[model samples]
Target: MPVREFSSSVPLWAKRIASAIYVERRRAGLTQAALASRAGVRQATVSQAENDPRSMRLDTLEKILASLDLTLASARRPH
Candidate 1:
């Protein structure tokens, strides 16, 4: 609910990355707030990463990804 899965403005690649993060967070049974707490970031940062990662700092994204048991490299790979 924190992120829109797709949109006219969002690129396919970014969507894929965002989807990966969104799916993993759901799979891990975590809300954006919970993930933020675990990742030591703000809920807004998690939301931004899930919806539009371009604005997110790499370290913040890394923290969120790590909290989901993922790595930046894995998120970049095509599904």
Candidate 2:
């Protein structure tokens, strides 16, 4: 799948996180229900995270990312 470019209106961090979750979930061939079950969250939560990651808590994001065998990494931005 092609990476989506969020407009300037959306926060860059939220867009990156949401896109990563969406791409990884699709790549893993797991439905929202399956992922949510593994993550110990509701299917709606998974859906919401993929659609609007900024609204999700850090722990919840971590759970979902872990379930998908993905990890969060940070890099310093060039100034």
Candidate 3:
């Protein structure tokens, strides 16, 4: 998959969620390696979630997020 940097122009929620994961991981004192080990995914997958392209499987993303006590939710855009 092609790699892309997250655009600062993107909405706050996107950046917030990403930042939350990083913050929480640090707060929980879990290294990316430890979280990946606990979540049964590769360390690279954890790195990808933090800094790589957004091309991982939804299920895998869900697994990683769930490991961090975060859940994906559906939302309606403001009209």
The estimated TM-scores of all candidates read 0.83, 0.78, 0.68
What is candidate 1's CA lDDT for residue 5? Answer: 51
Considering only N, C-alpha and C atoms within 3 Å, which residue pairs clash in candidate 2?
none
lDDT of each: 0.83, 0.75, 0.65
Q: Which residue runs of candidate 3 sit more than 4 Å off their true CA positions? A: 1-14, 74-79
Judging by lDDT against the true structure, name the best candidate. Answer: 1
Model 3 deviation from the true structure expressed as Cα RMSD, one decimal place: 6.9
Order of candidate numbers by TM-score, starting with the best: 1, 2, 3
Q: Give the poorly placed runs of model 1, Cα more than 4 Å off.
A: 1-4
lDDT (tens digit, per residue) of candidate 3 on 6-73: 67665555544455556566768999999898778998887776653256687887777788877655
What local lDDT does model 1 show for residue 25?
91
Candidate 1, residues 1-79, lDDT tens digits: the string is 4555567788776776787789899888999999999999999989988887876778888899999988887887664
Q: Give the root-mean-square deviation of each candidate in angstroms.
A: 2.7, 3.8, 6.9
Backbone clashes under 3 angstroms, per model: 0, 0, 0
